[model samples]
Target: MDVLAVSIFVFFFLLVTILGFAAARWRRADNLDNLDEWGLGGRGFGTFIAWFLIGGDLYTAYTFIAVPATLYAGSVVGFFAVPYTIVVYPIIFLFLPRLWSVSHRHGYVTPADFVQGRYDSKPLALAVAVTGILATMPYIALQLVGIEVVLQVMGIGVDEGSWLVGHLPLFVAFGVLAAYTYSSGLRAPALIAFVKDILIYTVIIVAVIYLPAQLGGWDAIFSAAQGSFDAFNTENADAIAAGEVGAKGSIPPAAAHWAYASLAFGSALALFMYPHSVTGVLSTRSRSVIRRNAALLPAYSFLLGLLALLGFVAIAAGVTVAGDPPNPQLAVPQLFENEFPSWFAGVAFAAIAIGALVPAAIMSIAAANLWTRNIYKAFINQDATPKQEASQAKIVSLVVKFGALVFVLALSKSFAINLQLLGGLWVLQTLPAIVLGLYTRWFHRWALFGGWAVGMGWGTWLAYGVSSPTQAHFGGPLVPFPGTETNVYIGVVALLANLVVTVVLTVVLRAMGVDEGTDQTQESDYRADAGDEGVEEELDLTAPAHG
Candidate 1:
């Protein structure tokens, strides 16, 4: 290991941990025994804090490493992340403000909480909560994959025989994270996001400019990447023809257009559906904060596009996979290692590691909120106090983080990307219930539940059957588009089936006079904003911590 690099990384990592612990005092909630204080940071973030927090939460460590890695290994197909993020802000712009408003009005801590209030169906709310927790697990695992790539590139914990020994650094990092998060709650991630974003923006900007020059230039990088992809495609031409695998390059062939479009669109729809994404929005002080960030958040998408190109830069730098099975996830970190001095490489590594921590914290908190409010409070104890709820969430948050770590340690790292895609597929099934339900209550609650079931079942089945040249199953995101020769994202196909099922079921159940659950929400509730009476308390950031 480069001692200088490790030292620099450890310094930043510890610094962030310090900030995480200090965050509990940063906002200084009068009471820490409630969901708003712990889970949503008192729901008092202004535009500036909300911008960094939401941006940091959504553009996670997974994107920093995995996007470039996929581009490096698979080519044009990986660029789908760019378009997906680009389109997401606009779609959420239309609906997230509504969600924020309604959630605020009801003091809802999770999307499932909103579902319960809106549909008045405990069972439907349970489905949303369960799906949120399940989808977040793999996403959290991908964050571990990001940190692991960074550690491997830094030459730390390189070749320990035992799995536990090999992942000691990861466990240490996660332990620090869990401690801070338990103490500071959502404030931890919100505070550390400032540092994480600054480092990431600095590292990405420097690497994109400096790395290309250090090798040749963008032209040379593209040429090298194209040549590598050409050779790869030639070697795997049969697989490509049979739709078993995709070719690697900056641009895809004509046959991949549908897959590209569908993946991008489906991912856009899924982005805001994830409970963590909604948690970020809900944590803001006002509906306007969500709206303004919707416009400003695209800045990260532009940065992500630049980050994705590092895969080509890796090709130009002659960076090769170091693992026995050849993990492409190492491409960006390895590229940094090859080009940068040890100290700066440590800064880059820290940026990626901290990036993972922010999202992981937010996801764990979101999942915990779902459990505490929808599952535990709803079923286990209706009389549970605010302190009990917060305590349960705190416990569940640690469990969620370590659960993700266990998943990564037990499974092949190759499954990280596929599992994240699986998370997207599963989370997207909630769109009709949450996103569409924002506008119309036409679909019965039972129908919404049926829709979720159909979407989840079909999506999982299709995802399981998808085979690549390397893996027999759970290979990639693309599956055969129903009723067409072209392939599309399985998420989209499942969503279509969900909508169809929901519509048909709604008509059948309505005509039969089946009981549609009561709606506990008012029409004006969806338009409520900050300062509205009965909304969660705002943070007293200027007040003394003990006041």
Candidate 2:
């Protein structure tokens, strides 16, 4: 192990751990025994904190490791993340404020809560809640995978010993994350995000500026990456032609144009559908804060573009991994280790590790809140008090983190990765139920539920049918568009099917005189801001959920 690097890593890690536990005291809520205070940091975060927290939540440790790794491995489509982030902000600007308004007006803590209020359908709300939790588990696992890669790069727990011995550090890190998140709730991540974003920006700025200068220049970096791709294509020409492996490239070919565009658009739609993203948006102070942060968040997309280029820099610098087939996820971390001074490399490692913690905390908390409000409070104990709800959420948050840890440790990393890819597709199924409900209650609740079921089943089937060289199922996000040779994102295609079913079923159901559930929200509710007529300073914990 590099002693200096490990020391710096440990120091920063400890700093965040201290910040995490201290966050509960930082906010100093009168009582956190309610969803509003515990699940959402009192629902009072301003522009600056919301910016960092949501940015940190969306641009995750997995992103830091995986996006560059895809580029380093010569997959040009991975750069879709830049455009995906760009596309998502305008959508957020348009719709998330409405969600925030309606959620605040109804004391809704999760998107499912909004669904329940809008449609007055418990079964539909439960579907949304369950989808959120299932999709989030593998996402949290990917964060652990991010930390594990950094640990491996640092030689922290790699040894000629049992699996348990090799992953003790990971377990210890998991323990720390679970402890403070259970204590501080959303405040933990909201506070630590300041440190996480600063460190990430510092490292990426330095890497983009310093690495290119060291490796001759951008010209040499591109040339090196292209030459490497050419060599690999030549070496594996048969495999490429036989459909066993994909050709490498710096730019998407004409054949991949639809694939690239669809991935970007699909990902943009899916990003905020995740419960954690909703958690970030709802925690903000007002409608304007959501819009302001949406506009400002694009700056992170610029940063992501620069960060993605580091993959080419890694190629030029000749960073390599040790594996039968080299694990590309290690490329960026390996580049930091090989190119930077030991102490600075540790800073970069800590950035990735802390990047994991912030999102993991938020995801677990979001999932827990779904359980408390939508599942536990809605079903098991309809008359449960706010304190009981909070207690359940706290315990479930720990359970969620522990489940994620087991997902990473017991299962193959590839399994978690593939499931995360499907997670995006699965969460997109809820878009009609949640996002559409904000605008109009035209679609019947049962129709929305049917659409979700169709989308979930079809998307999973499509993803499962995809096969890559190393994996037989759940291998990728893109599939051949039906009745055409062109490939498109599975989520986009599944969503189309979902919409078709929902639109058709709605007309039939309305004509048949099917009972549309009572709409609980008024037209003005969507436009309400903080301190509006029915919006309370704090959520009314004792108020019954609207049906």
Candidate 3:
């Protein structure tokens, strides 16, 4: 073990764990007996806290590890992440304020809650809740992947004997995370985000600037990356011919342009649809906070752009893939291990591990809210009280985190990787019902459901048929663009299919006089903001904590 690195890592981790538990009282509510207090931090985070929380939550450790890993494993194509994030803020900026306004006015806790209120269809709300939960399972698992990668690079948890021994440290790390998250709820992540973001920015800024200079310069890095891609092409010619140009330059070739653009656009649309993303938005104090953060969050996208380039930086640093079977996720972490002192390496590792915790906490909370509000309360216990709901959410959040732990450990790492890819595809199917429905209720609720089914089916089928030299079927996100030999993002194709089905079925269903459910929302509600007069009074959390 790298004793110095491990010591520093433990110190920072224990500090964050302390902070996570203490956050329950940071902006302590009188009581924590409702979704508002527990699930959303009383829906009162200001602009400053919201910025760090949302930024930290969305740009997760999985992102930190995966974006560079993709770039390292492939090349230019992985850069779709950069453009996608750059465009996502603008897309969310256009609609999220309205969502924040209406949700606050109606006391909605999850995206599913808004769907149920807007469409007045419990089935549709359940669908949204289920989708959110399903998509989030793998996402939460991938966060653990980020932590595990760090642990492995630190020369710990490499035991090849029992699987339990191999992942014990990871379990211990998440055990602490799950504990504090259960105690503090949204506040845990919101408060811990401050330290996570500061460490991440420091590590990223120092690495990006200092590493390039140490490795010669940007020109050398680019040249080395190109040389590496050339070698990859020569070795994997068969893969390239099978529509998998696994390596390329900083700019995509003409043949791959559609794939790049569609991936970028599809990811942009799906970014805010994730339940965790919505949780972050709803925690803020006002609609203007949502809009201002939209403008400000691009700072993260800029940092992500820098992070993606680290893959190329790895190539220039002569960081070789080192394992029985090479793991590309190690590119950035390994680069640090090779170049930095053990203490700073520990700091970078702590940054990544904490990065994972913030998002995992938020995601588990979001999933739990979905379960409590849309599933348990909606069906299992319709008369559940505020205290009961909060209790159920806390219990469910713990279950979700442990479930994700099982998912990562029981399955192959390859399965975890593929699930992350599919998570976006599956979540994007909700756009018609959630995003577009926010503007116009033209969609028949059943039609939206039908569209969701078709999009999910078609996307999964196409993804199953895609093959590459490394793996058979479901190889990557790009598939053949309809009516052209070129590839496009499967999520976009699925989303387009989803939209088409919804449009066609809406016209038919309306013409045939099928019932369109009542919309519980109003135009004025969509315009409501903090301190709006007609907004419902928040549940009185002043009652003592009740089991």
Candidate 4:
């Protein structure tokens, strides 16, 4: 049964890879030389593909595994992901069009590029670059977590093989991912998002619909899940009590209103700041495209709410497994394997694996854009050609993927999850730099760095202090309540600190007559269309690609 499921999973993944590499020709662009074409799909994806691409990129295998797993573990905080996503779309709706217009006008593929072009401040751009890279690494590692959870549930691992067993799966997973990503650039994953989302939707919708009937229905599932929650909180009630105050350094304890609000708010701020999400937003051809996506993207958030409940559904359905990790990330996959036919389970597994592919490609591409503009073009080769920059991006992307792969294999699985919590910590720190930088350049560049530094330091220190049953010192989400044993997300708390520092420092810096960096854009540029000043000119490529 496991072998049959594995084969089906392999077959579908292969198909996606073929389709991925085939994307270079999907739209059939004249020249893929410019970053505009390769990085942002020529800045011209319409609504349908844009929806799936953004949705597929945002809702990855980690989401599939991790959301349900959070429910499974009786930690309500995991459920915060749903509301957080829900709120994020509306927030994006408010800001994304402005960002789209500015980025498109400036021919910027990354937020850092925009920061560099907008403020004309090298240090500020560099800070955005470094923050993006740091935040994205753990996110990429989280993709590996989704895949790993699927592998573990499928009962496939290295215990049996001499050479091909332990290392082969990793090699194969990355090799195909790397191959297709390099070949297709953004288009591969953008095109393939349609299939990935469909499979995920079908598998999840079917599972949620059918599993309840098989397990006695929604009432039964809910009651059973509630029972588990009661048991978990009672047994580990002390820890749950401490989470409300601190949110330690990551997320708050899932026990009450504050937990949901923090998760929703913190994730809302962090989501747009992440490079992959920005990549998807930046790829659209026009401001209208971004606005439409902002409004429609919330539809995906609705699906996420249903998906979060599945953890409780799994719990209530009396699902059980052997040798399970004490994490919720595994709940959905384990539930499917326990409750469904192997053939159907294969479909679920494929949904997760392919889900990982879309965002992984987008993330690698976004990270590559950062490297090309911020590092390579900005500092290393100010006079690089378009083709040269494109080629350089391709190479750097491979290194980034491998670096994440090393982070995955080196860190303990438990530690990796906490690292994502820390990613939330770092990504939130970029809000003032990227998202706020969109509206006003009122704050000084040096002040922005100061706020980021303070927030990051406090967040890291708090996160380092958290402990859980399986590991110690940065092993669990940080919490603050004392006697009652509650917890809060560290990122939310740290973000508060960041905002304070940014506000206070901005005022101080302003009073001190600091050079707050020049704003290259006026308020009008945020609403500019395709024909405006500094908008991309279709110049002959015979010259260089530098601005």
TM-score of each prediction: 0.97, 0.98, 0.96, 0.90
Off by over 4 Å in 3: 235-239, 242-247, 536-547
Query: Which candidate wins on lDDT?
Result: 2
lDDT at 24, model 4: 87
Tens-digit lDDT track for model 4 on 92-195? 88888888888877677899888887767887788888888888877887887778778878877544556457656766888888888887789899988988
The residue-level lDDT of candidate 2 at 112 comes to 95
lDDT of 3 by residue, 1-547 (tens): 7899889899989999999999888777887789998999888777889999999989999899989887787656888888889899888988999898889888899999999999889998999999999999899999998999999888888798877888889989889999999899998999899999999999999999899899898999888988888888888888777765555566788988888899999999998999999999998878888899999999999999999999989888888866757888889999999999999999999999999999999999999999999999999999999999999999999999898898778888888888888999999999899899889988999999999999999999999998865689778888997888999999999999999999999999999999988899998988897778755334223332321
> Which stretch of 10 consecutive residues in model 2 shows the poorest summed lDDT?
538-547
lDDT, model 3: 0.89
Model-by-model lDDT, in order?
0.89, 0.92, 0.89, 0.78
lDDT of 4 at 127: 81
> Could you tell me the TM-score of candidate 3?
0.96
State the lDDT of candidate 2 residue by residue for 298-367, as single tens digits.
Answer: 9999989999998888999999887778899999999999999999999999999999999999999999
Candidate 4 differs from the real structure by a C-alpha RMSD in angstroms, to one decimal, of: 4.4
**What is the C-alpha RMSD, rounded to one decimal, of candidate 3?**
2.5
Give candidate 1 misplaced runs (Cα > 4 Å).
235-245, 540-547
Which rank order by lDDT, best down to worst? 2, 3, 1, 4
Model 2 regions more than 4 Å off? 539-547
Compared to the true structure, candidate 1 yields what TM-score?
Answer: 0.97
> How far in Å is the alpha carbon of 461 misplaced in model 3?
1.2
